[model samples]
Target: MSIARARLAVIIVSYCNADDVDRCLRSLARSDLDQFEVLICENGGEAAYTNLLARLVGPDRILKRISNDSDVLDLPQKRLASVASCRFQARANVVRIGLAIDNLGYGGGVNAWLEPLLSVPDWDAVLVLNPDTEVDPRALSELVAKSAAGYGMVGGNLVFDASPDKIINYGLHWSRMTGRVIAIGRNAPVGSTPSAENLAKIDAISGACVLATRACVEDVGLMAEDYFLYMEDLDWGLRRGKHRIGIADKAVVRHIGGTTIGSAVTIEKRSDLSIYLSARNSILYARRFAGWRWICHFGIGLLYAARYLIRGSSSAGKVALAGLLDGVNGKTGRPKVVPGAR
Candidate 1:
């Protein structure tokens, strides 16, 4: 089926960041695409986001009951006359807001919405977008176009929300040999373009804004739920078999990197939770994919911990060490909250 004619479903998982979700929904309201649906899986937040969203998208547009399913709440559809007409408009799009009963981690939250969608065969593509992101109006369209062009999974270029002109990642490259996951264009200026050869293919796409075909998801399976937070994207890509992954540079998303867990400004300022999960997940990823080469993975982790300690990040080093040990012992799920963290 042609992507343009095919139905699209966008799933955004949110955790206690109502304001960020508001901004993200407003941006999506401006999408140039004619037809699509947004399924927002709200993972435990104290604020009454349903009411907040009603105000943003209008109460009349908010649906009371979507289905018998306890997990999903489908929002009402309000026709949008034009983009210049209002701040929030449901338009021709169907918006389903699913309030998760608990605080499911990233992958788990996504699966909350994804599982139900998978049962229905109408969708051609599914876009997993981060809540703390404001996508370019053309972003989804570009991603869909790429999916229709035969790419199994396609990701958009992500730029820092604070410094919109600085590139965060074009795509990701994971080296199984060294157990390293590198962001292709970490700190390059936004306008700088890569050579065609460099843009030809990528090892993995950022989970920040990934678009995948139904076929890809069916083949690769859902995002690894075991990875509660990080490295799930690389795992999904690696498991794609012979499917090609590509980046749509024309599709750009402004992302607030750590709105829920990490530092909003830079990766260098990652929080304890971010550090712990990343450290643990890296080990888990290697163990699952690398087999006997897991020893090399452990060595690389030791080097990482040493670098953190040498750089005077004692907390980072300590958490990383604890995480590595926990992963080796097969511990998983949300880590205990670091003291004094709100």
Candidate 2:
């Protein structure tokens, strides 16, 4: 199909960030496309649902109250109960908001939406976008164009929102020996493109902005819920059987990276949740994919936890150690202990 006629479904997993969702939807409205829909899973529970409703509908009651179950939309009525459908910011895009029963992490939140829509033949491609991003007007078109050319999975150029002129990643580089995943072309000039060799080495597209064709989704299945937060994107790429991945350089997205988890380039600045999940998932990833290299993965995880201690982030250090232990025990799904859970 041609890019102009391609039906796209944009999926966003939101957590306590209705304002960010507002911005993201506004940017999406500028896309130069004829047909598209957005599916959002508000993973922050009841309070977040109210906030999202207030932000999207104001006081006019464009959509009915949540507890009034009779008013709910029936698009994905299986596991979820109060999924609501509405249009935001006067756009033609059909926005469906699914309320999560609990905090389902990133993967589960996305699955809440994808599981219901996979069989729906309306959408040609699915673009998983972070709620904190603002896309260039031409970005969606470029991605659909690449999808039309038969790329199973595609990623666009991501730049830091703080400094839009500097690139955050062209894609990602994974080290099997050390269990480290690094962004290719990180902090490089925005206009710079990676060499073909560098692009070929990309282990996976960063989860921040990944576009997967419907067939690819069918082949790989939904996002893995084992890791919950980090490393699942790489896991998805590793499991892409026979499907090819490509990059659309013209598709630019400005990302306000790590708003929910407090992730940062420097270890000292990362939140406890971010540190723990990163450390835990790295080991989990190695256990799944790495052969004897799992030992190296453990060593690297230990060093990372130690770095947090040495850098004086004692809380983060403790969390990282706990996560490593949980990972070693093959614990998966939502963590037992969470930030401020006490």
Q: What TM-score, to 2 decimals, does candidate 1 have?
A: 0.84
TM-score of each: 0.84, 0.91
Q: How well is each residue in 1-342 modelled by candidate 1, as lDDT tens digits?
A: 012222888888877777778788778878887667777776664354455455445455422322222222232212111111122344545566656656678888778767767776667989999988998899889889989989999987789888988888878777777788887878777746555655654567888888889999988888888778998888888888877877676888999878888643333677878777777888888889889787788788888977878988776788887777777877777765642232
Q: Which runs of model 2 end up more than 4 angstroms from their true locations?
A: 1-6, 59-73, 338-342
Q: lDDT per model, in order?
A: 0.73, 0.80
Q: Which ten residues in a row have the lowest lDDT in candidate 1?
A: 76-85
Best model number under TM-score: 2
Rate residue 88 of model 2 by lDDT: 43
Off by over 4 Å in 1: 1-6, 45-90, 189-201, 264-268, 337-342
Candidate 2 residue lDDT tens string, 214-310? 8999989999987889987898888887877787888889999888878886866677777778877888888889988988888888888788779
Q: Per-prediction RMSD in angstroms?
A: 6.1, 4.0
Score residue 81 of candidate 2 by CA lDDT.
Answer: 51
Poorest stretch of ten by lDDT in candidate 2:
63-72
